[model samples]
Target chain A: MKKLAILFMMVGILIVFPGVLQGQASLKELTLSERTIQDPMKSWTITFTQPINKGTLKKQNFLIKDDKKRQVKAKLSLSKDEKKVTITPESPYKKGVTYYLYIKGNVKSGSNAFLNEHTVLPFKIGAVPKESKNSSGKTTTNDKQPASSSGKTASSGSDSKSSSNASTSTSSKTPGKNLVKVQTKKHSHFDEISVQVSDYVTKVKAGSNEFEYKGNNLFVLYQPGLKSGEKITVKGYSMSGKVLETKEVVIP
Target chain B: MKKLKGIGVAFILLLSILMPALNQSVSAAAAPRIDHTSPAANEQNVPIDTDIRIYFNSDIRGISSQYIKLFEKSNGTYYDFPIKTVKKDGEALHILPEKSLGFNKEYMVQFNGPAVDLLNGTYNQHLSYTFQTNYIDFYELMVVNEGRLMNMLDTYAPRQIKAFAPKRYINEISVIHKKTGSLKGDQASFNGITNIDINTKSEDVVNVHVDIMKDGKSLQKGYASKVTGTKASKNQFTFDIGFSNIPDFYDVRVTVLNNAQQTIDSKIIKFAAEDGKAITSFKESYKYKTAGNGYTFHELLSKESLFADLLAESMMQDIKVQVEDR
Candidate 1:
């Protein structure tokens, strides 16, 4: 195990900073002509690295949410070659509001390779005023704030804190911008479990206790001493030492 | 909670000790025995050519084959025959005799002595069985110079050529006999086929052509030759056609023509060139398949020899299967 612990640490580091290993271009991308929450929501185009199967492109894979995490309905369609997909919102974008568009990594390419990474795109419907940033061009709090001066759309600070607390419970459930989804698989000969890091985690729990990091996944020698059907739970830690997420895996 | 834990530990400990003792007693008491056998013991009319299967209650040690013997009882004597085993699992054996048994013959097999089982226990018992075969009587062209046929092929050929030249292909005989000195040809060991393609319009009028081909080229051919029998002139239907000189080895195509010179039928007869092993597959196909042509010859076989032949084949096949599986 000392080597195994080093392996887990490497996996945790890789999960936290994936773009450092693979180029950003390797991931599927979504293109937006305009990001401002102005009005009259139009369509957004999503392109995959490889041609995808049309049947696997489900609307559920595209989750459009508001700041409160409330889902917005949308229609998704794939092109004939299935390389490109278009997602159209049923309702127009509300001005001064930010929407979060989350696409899952489970979408399959025609040849069966999955998109394998979830992407989150956060954009507003309206543009910021020209003078929102300081002359030094550093993005200060002012630039980060919603551009809309309209008070009706600005969320209350209390509600934001409450939503943040609610989100902490199942932090790494989805493939977030910073979190890599831990998908564990077992075979007759080997058992592998990926120790995923959520957005907040800078390290993963994958050392000692018979756990060793092998690249992106942690492998237990065959299996844990857990009885049949027992599950092993692991926790991901944030840079500040807070628990970001807890994951459980079982082996036969 | 603590009391329940203690009880659980005690229960597991009890099982660990009792289970092994119980298993040992049961295993020691049981003996390896045959659960069932193909052609069933004392079976009659068994196919002249087939494999034998023996299923045992317990696995037999592979070395136990030395304790088994399969032979034919001809004239109250035993003759060793060719056998090939296919599958020999610890609990099962498949025997395939390399040749077909003569029709209406008796075959015998005995499993003697320390037949060991998986548990290292010896089954010190003797088991024997006899079975009869019923098939279209098939006859072989025998070259009997008081049993040893003269070798005409090469140095490997039987050393007694002059010993059997006078009665070459004259006397028809069974595929096997208890006589130890018989130097039968490899082809003679096979039960002559009730081949569908070998009919003659009239034994004397038909023109039979025997062509010996090597690598698809006819090395030799014989036509309008005289091949006489023991008492009567050899008919076209049952004569062994010979090349001018016995060359190296086997497949010969026999083509028959009607008196008008019209081609009637033909067949390729394959024989093993060495070891006295018969071409079992050829005989088996003939035995199992329906003869498409209207032709047959009557002959008799010893049931005892045929049974032993079948048992030997199955046992041999079983061993082969075991080797392959291993």
Candidate 2:
């Protein structure tokens, strides 16, 4: 009995010791969505909700890689609040390509707790297809077919039918992909918003095809076939995309 | 020991979180200040034509519309000229006067505060300068004249003449004199004689006489009463002399008389009408040069006469008359 108890104690020590020494390093709930961008090529802002501890936060590590594992490197910088880090890819990512984000040990929580040291979070980047091909190897319908107009069938042909089904499933799985999330304070003069996806933010001028945001209320000057709660990505730098106030908008 | 390790890890994280915040505060405090304006403050005696410009130590972003104002001291009126409308040469404000200021008048330029640097949002204090307009000392008068005259040999002829004369003086010009031969030898005998004997083509003898011949064929004829007084101003004159049927060549003598009836000047002028054949031949040659082929005789003669008259008038008007300048 004494031997058994001693063995049990040793086993407990081994398990608990590793736990304590390893430190509670974990990625907080990571929120992902397309950031509103105006200029997609030059620069973009990707916002995270969780505040990072600047001291323990190591350099943000990310890679843009294709399905074939061809890797493209990216640079990252922490905002003043350390709650957000903007990832600028060394080269612009290809449209319609899936990319994986491997954040290394450097990222930390507001309490200076390191996030997942080895695990990488993966996400895909793609643009809304202006047009799709048909199985007949001929273009049945040009890109001029409006996406949401006339309630026409989303699928033009067999291949388009598959593509449409896939896009619909992907969007439904990630509801955030269709939301331009902006956080505003009640009656406050300004608010600091965050961008999470790599996209553009553009202002549709008044009397043009753009919408206006009046104190967090969005209104379209001209109808762009957009329903309520649709997503739009604006691109430009306002205080380095950490704090931007825009009044004009457009349906993406 | 496990708890201690956990605490160590937490402490490291905490330090990492606070590092960036600490660095930002330091940089914000080290931002530079505006040193001085390019045009020094309270500068005076600037030229009226000078464009006012200002410079700061650092690159600026905003220039307020209300910052620049011009004031008229005489009327105590002030007006604002927006910076955008004001031309910019580098950092300078190009202020153009709507109307030039009167000579030796005092004016003021005021630069108001709130011309803030765009990057830093720092405002400048109100600065004013008083300047006086210097006398430009340029006065000019341009005179243009168009008229006619009769002299043919006068090469100084012009259809138009422009003259510059001092406004302070009254210019005086004497009448032009026509050249003529003096009475000598056979002509001397008729110098003082008022009456001359003339033979006409009809063989009738008539007396050709005149009071005086001023020059060439400008004859003073008839009774002193018949000679109308010079009707134009002292600056101009016109006269008419009459003659009856006379020989081809004739001499007329005249004596000049003052209002007191005393002789003051006397002279005799001779005129000749060549034979009909000679006169016709000369006329034909003149016609060929001026009116042959495509030309019309009447038009050519009129044009030539008009040109000669215009040339002579221009010469007379352009002749320098002595005048005083102050």
Candidate 3:
């Protein structure tokens, strides 16, 4: 009877030892929050619950895939402390795009154990504003304002007024008052019609059909010909486009 | 008792016999023997003009003719110099330099492994040695920074110096100043100058001067200065000034004559200054934003901006590009 008892005890010890040793070898646990797609042009930091082992991380190991399992622009970088892995897209993540994050092969836990095989974290990107297209086939009006060319109609005039109001609301939120204000001025000289785009009125070349625009102190030029006193809409694209400004110009 | 005694005796004999063999094996693995070298190892400071020669005892196989490398210490960075090898006297390996080494600088020659002995199939260990070149007589002066200038000897002048300034700043560099009586037109001059400006709208300008002299006589001089151009929309400018006709035997000196000088500020830079090169110029468009996660596009932009600013300030004869993390 004593021998049987001893045999049972030995079996239990053998089974439990491996488990204890494995537990000790475990380095740390890592938890990833739901993935998010913010600004693509800007870098986004993905926070992790715990630091991960960076030694096992390689460029090709982590991947981002669309719903069809097709690969998209993706890059993985490990933090200095080996705590977090920051994934970045080569381009901005398109709004309203869904993607899956897959952690594979080279990814390892802090204890140097391989991460779960085929580990995948899926998430959807937010909706982005679609580019507006002109269905009328006459002239396409951009997100800036009503078609600057079709300013003769009352409907167009009312559209310009609403856009101008929107531009004012956007400009008030701008950080600095000295910020260059962009205005679109339309001109027409018979067959040659040109629009002048300038950040400030001072930088505009009067009657020359050439105008310059400024943002972040950078200057850009636009040349379009239109008649004098013609109602034209000017719109501004800020770094964030949050401070878009549109103004009416009378070409002299 | 008898069996136990026999076992003990056998164990002792085994240990004694294996001990010497183990010791020999460990020593052989730990320290490799130096067979022979071309110019020979532990050779005293040799001439900088001479090609490096090293010969090993074993016939080396699978050794790449281009495996040898030369490194120079610069600003805490190891800059690699290309080395060429020639087969001489049948078995000896000779490394020749495409260009003479800088004087008074410590250089290291390294042989990458895969240098194998043809006879025994044993690999030759990686080999390296450090040595200094003989000093040249004249000093070379260059502008490394707006406020900081490098004073160097002709034998030890750096291949290049990096500078930073606004896009619109005018850069003027003169190896030997024609305006100063110290340097004659016929005499060799190492004096140079560079000027540059990047902020044309702001009208920001950076002017600097570099000079080398000995006993009140200028050996090398350089000057650079720039002003805003006709295009108010364009704000950046770069220049490269070369120091030619450097005379032998002179001390080096460098000074920031003017951080920003214009015609209105004619007396901005001091008349006399000190020390030092090849002129190379580069330019790149600037972008402001972060490109991706764990990566800041700002750094790339800064590097591009710095390179463009430097290239505009110097005359670079040649440039080599190496891509990493691609």
For each candidate, the alpha-carbon lDDT, in order, equals 0.43, 0.33, 0.37
What's the TM-score of every candidate structure?
0.24, 0.19, 0.22
> By lDDT, who's the top model here?
1
lDDT of 2 by residue, A1-252 (tens): 999999999889879786654442542222222211222342223333345556643433444455677776666676776544555667765655655454444444554434332323334543332222232334322211111100000112223111110000011111112124433221111111222211222122222222232211122222212334444333321111221222223232
Candidate order (TM-score): 1, 3, 2
Q: Report the poorest 10 consecutive residues by lDDT, candidate 1 chain B.
A: B317-326
- Docking class for candidate 1: incorrect
Per-residue lDDT tens digits for candidate 3, residues B62-126, read 45655567787666667887665445443456667666654446677786875534433444567
Q: Which lDDT tens digits does candidate 3 get at residues A55-142?
A: 6566555667777767877677767766446567786556556665655533444554443223344444532322322222233222
